[model samples]
Target: MSNTETSPQGSQPDTPGPHSPEPPDAAPKARGLLRSSALVGLMTMLSRVMGLIRDVVVANYFGAGSSADAFFVAFKIPNFLRRLFAEGAFSQAFVPVLSEYRSLKDLAAVKHLVDRVAGSLGLVLIVVTLLGVLGAPVLAAIFAPGFYMNDPLRYGLAVDMLRFTFPYLLLISLTALAGSILNSYERFAVPAFTPVLLNLSLIGAAIWMQPLFQQPVMALAIGVLIAGSAQLLFQLPFLWRIQLLPAPTLGFRDEGVRRILKLMIPALFGVSVSQINLLLDTLLASFLQTGSVSWLYYSDRLAELPLGVFGIAIATVILPSLSRRHAEKSTEHFSRTLDWAMRMVLLIGLPAAMALLVLAEPLIATLFHYGEMADRDVTMAAMSLRAYACGLLAFMLIKVLAPGYFSRQDTKTPVKIGIVAMVVNMVLNLILIWPLAHAGLALATTLSAFLNAGLLLRGLLKEGVFTWQSGWFKWLLQVGVANLAMIGFLLLLAGSAEQWLRFDMWQRVSHMAVLVGGGATVYLLVLLITGMRLRHLRH
Candidate 1:
């Protein structure tokens, strides 16, 4: 996860070590990838549990009110910047450089590389943070325009909260750097699980902060600032264990650091386009009505559960392998490796995406439609959820495909593609917003995602980096068949779930269990009938 891995200074092709090649019967690279993915998935499951708890508390406390709306928009600003810079673009560039350093067995070189990048990044973050702090009101205005026009007090409060919490971008970005270094070393669980601390800190704050402040929203905002600090500190021990814990310095002369900056500039757009696109929707939604932000947030939270579990796990596991393979110039390995990962992504991502579309209402009702959230909010959120699900494959593909470009040290390509797709998204959003309202914005995001995925695939083909095989078509057919089976199973028998789907906590669990269990069985049964062997991706 360290910037050293992807830093421009170390952006060279991977060379084979003396022991690079193994026998053909040797362990398939996909197996190691899947194994690490499973470990990360397991840890992420725990983190998401805490996340759900945190969200439930949030919904209970705020209930899609104006206060909740303001808080989400405020929180999203720094969070988006954190992802845009640290975890998203900066790390993508940094990973390859750091990995190259490891491949070359250059420890001191890696340390110096780490110091330079970390120092330079820290300096950049401070300036960015200050600028953002000064401009929180304007930034909020841009991201959620309705806030300024409709509710002056909420907007002002959001600005003050942003000022308090904006430092989180610096801390979390640095934390992400630490996590990236650990991930490069195959220590996936610790880094993956660190998010749990965030949820816990927020939960603790929510419970205790209320007693301290008469205004619950202000308390929530202060809690957010505390939680951000907690998340940064939580990753410290993990960094120390890996011996890459960065010390404070101002040494920005290192060339490795320069390369990371080079890659990061492009990745800022390439990686953050989806969020940026979503932010655009939030800005538009601000004008629609109250609770628009909450509606989008709730819908996205449902989709994010599966995306985090499967899409993120698969992407995180395969990146190092992809980087290593590309560095080695093993074309066969690279092509086969990518194909295997795509299969894995589709394996989990498709079903997760589909389930949400079919079970949107039930899932939303079971999880949300309680407290002050209301039936109408649930309906609107469900509509948004289905729209979001429609593009899940595309969203997941971006995660998989962008890595192909990043690993090849070609961040510029995705940036170009992202720009085009973003333009389409903006146009579609404008066209659809009037007719479909908030749901249209979501649909626009989904459509633009598939467009981005298509472009990335085309680039991959043009460069001859990867290609489809005979099995690819067969797999697609099987996947379609499985999807049809899932649709009919749920569509025909959804009445059965009505009895099981109650807002009571245990009842909600039982509902998700029955639907997920029944739906999964049908998918597997169809796939088995169509000869979709596990051997394809599991190997």
Candidate 2:
């Protein structure tokens, strides 16, 4: 592995090769983290809005039915692997090393690492994609065993769709690799915006191509396949502009590639515990009822909106910054960066979670209760949505906290914590599933997330890697008061689920807009009144 300690101050000599237009600043400025995070957040918000629209369309067409269940499972298998390998482990592993290279080596050396990693990753993905295509039945059966045993038709649909969607793993993982590179250079917008293509492609497929398919859900599968390619292609130009576009070369024996692999292997388990737990929920939910998987999917999508937009946006910006700080041996800056991230997570995550919990039914009913999505589907999905919402803060915490370890290239501690959390989740699933059914699975995941977040925070504290910044008590109290105020406002404004159900789509949209906008306004006002200021969030 490249030595980061060589440059304790993180000063780089001017070396010839392509480099980012931005200057290399070892110490993070007050606006840098917040500005970059906002840019990424804005782009991610666009993608997530499109994703919600796509889900709304899918719900109108498929609803929480057997076909929807099949499609979700098929899509989820690759999506799970994408998060596990690409976004979760690969990003966690690659960014820190990339940061080291950029800080210590010339741009030429950085490009070489990118090329070798690309070639190696691409080769593995091709083999995996081919195997997944050929073994769709096996994958489907393993992921959704209930379908295999009880619903052969659904199982068959899932198997067929898996053949189409599984290749998405290969394409999207490459996209993620490109994204990680872009992120390392602080080019956050393109990668953050790339997901909009997926949502757009899926929306186009559902609207235009569904009629051509004998099984309409299969159109969605084709959409997934197309979106993966589109997303990968979309980032290439930006990569070229940055002059870090990879020219693939086999480099399994290369030192940097080997190091990334070593880190990524352990991180596969450590960084993706939440995804693994969700997949487990899917696995078990497959057996519960026809629509259990779909209910969970809908609810999870809504839960992911704030997470993707804010939690991930913040994490994405911080990893490269944190890694640079670590490379510079700037322990105080690293801890401060983390503290800033945690505060941001709490500032946004608290009210978001409360709003989701308070307005779960209304959100589900407004966005998804249309056409084929029945009232019962909305009710069931809302239940799981609320359950997932309860864990929103924990989920966001994990996003921010895990990066603290990953930026330092320490994956083992999170792996151990993740294992304990996963086991506890399984136990909770078994104990709760009998009584609460699908929502039980959601609840179990939520509870396990709290455990995961708590352990991660504890580890960081114990290591003295993340010291508590002063005024935390005041920060928490202010956030708590603001959140309580938001909750009360939302509960007062958000009518019953049945009222939302009876309203037409326009009414639902208007009412939801008011509740969301109002609740945010109230929360911000309360926080400001409690003496919080924008400057407090600066690192």
- Compare the candidates by TM-score and give the number of the best one: 2
- What TM-scores do the predictions have? 0.92, 0.96
lDDT against the true structure, each candidate:
0.80, 0.91
Model 2 lDDT at residue 350: 85
> Evaluated with lDDT, which candidate comes out highest?
2
Steric clash count of candidate 1: 21
| Residue-wise C-alpha lDDT for candidate 1, range 1-539, written one tens digit per residue | 34322323322223333322433223334236777788788888888878888887888778898888888888888888887888899878988877777665555566677777778888988899889889988988887778898889778877877887787887788888888877876677877888888788778777778678666766667776777677778777666655667775676666777788888888899977898888898889999888888999999888888778777887787777778777767788787767877887787888888889888888877776667777788788888999999998888888888888998889999999999999999999999999999999999999999999999989998999898755777888899889889988887756533443345768776767887899999999999999877566563
| Per-residue lDDT of candidate 2, residues 305-384 (tens digit) | 99999999999999998988898898998999999999999989988898888898899999999999999999999999
| Superposition TM-score, candidate 1 onto the true structure | 0.92
Candidate 1's C-alpha runs over 4 A off are 1-31, 496-506
Cα displacement (Å) at residue 9, model 2 = 26
Candidate 2 residue pairs in backbone clash: none
